[model samples]
Target: MSNIDIRHAHSLPPEQARQAVQDVADKLADRFGMVTGWSGNTLNFSRSGVDGHINVAPSELHVTAKLGFLLSTMKGPIEAEIRRVLDERFT
Candidate 1:
């Protein structure tokens, strides 16, 4: 399995940070057919070949994911998109 881990610092307050995380979750769900649910500050998500969570903290957002064999080959582009989205929302 291949992994993706990304972190971004955010200046927003907790509530707004969470809202920002949710916004990203919503986009992921819409674009990738990912099913997402929140457990406290961590949002869990899963779909074929992909599984991960978005963690919302006071000062930053962290995303961790594992990609299956076939998807693993696409890691570079996937990480790029994830970073792009995180940067767009958090920074």
Candidate 2:
């Protein structure tokens, strides 16, 4: 999938990054089949009925994290899936 821009930003210290990322994860959880679970250094979001995973990582001193997803070979219309979830949930 291609990159989609999201508006909104604010300065946040390193320690707050985890909470910020968690907020996004919480919203994503509302989407159908979007199960959110966290591990030590990453937050995992499963989507497309468990066919893919969106990996979220929050870096220090940044207001936003770099979010990435692993698309399944069987997954079709990957970008639309991501956009729908992000627009309805993250934005």
Candidate 3:
């Protein structure tokens, strides 16, 4: 019943970053049972008892991922997945 928020900074344009987020979301949608959709510069989804949101602005990619699970439970894997997705998109 608690939440954790994360913010990321990117060097890409908002539109591009939003697309990247959408791509990641698309890959994660059905399997994870999250509604992966884009609205403006934001991508939002929730699944596996967690809420995942990403916002893209010019030069920034902000992420807010939260789960009712303990931090120790979801932190590492989620962070790693985000890193992998970003690397695939932006690098």
Candidate 4:
């Protein structure tokens, strides 16, 4: 398995940051065919070959995902897309 862990800091307040993360999570779930569940401020999501969590906090969002071997080689593009979306949304 391969792992992707990224945490980005933001200046948005807790509520706004939470909403932003939730929106991103929803979009990701739709695009990736992920199933998600939430536990307080954290969203847990998974698909056939991936498992991850998005942790929302007052000043940051942390995303961590593990990919199965077949998908691991595409990690670069996956990470880039994630970074692009995060930058567009939070920066």
Best by lDDT: 1
TM-scores for every predicted model: 0.94, 0.42, 0.75, 0.91
Candidate 2 vs candidate 3: the TM-score winner is: 3
Lowest summed-lDDT stretch of 10 residues in model 3? Answer: 1-10
For model 1, name the residue pairs that clash. Answer: none
Query: Candidate 2, residue 9: CA error in Å?
Result: 11
lDDT of 3 by residue, 1-91 (tens): 4454656567776667766777777778756767776677678787667776787878767778777655547777777777766766765
RMSD of 4: 1.1
Off by over 4 Å in 1: none
Report how far off residue 26 is in candidate 3 (Å). Answer: 0.4
3-83, model 1: which lDDT tens digit per residue?
A: 999888888999999988888889889998999999999999999999999898888888999999999999999999988
lDDT (C-alpha) at residue 51 in model 3: 78
lDDT for residue 66 in candidate 3, whole number 0-100: 76
Candidate 2 on 55-90: residue-level lDDT in tens? 333322112222344443424464455455445533
TM-score of 3: 0.75
Candidates' C-alpha lDDT: 0.90, 0.46, 0.71, 0.88
Model 2 — which ten-residue stretch has the worst lDDT?
A: 58-67
Relative to the unseen true structure, what is the C-alpha lDDT of residue 56 in candidate 4, on a scale of 0 to 100? 85
Query: What lDDT is obtained when candidate 2 is compared to the true structure?
Result: 0.46
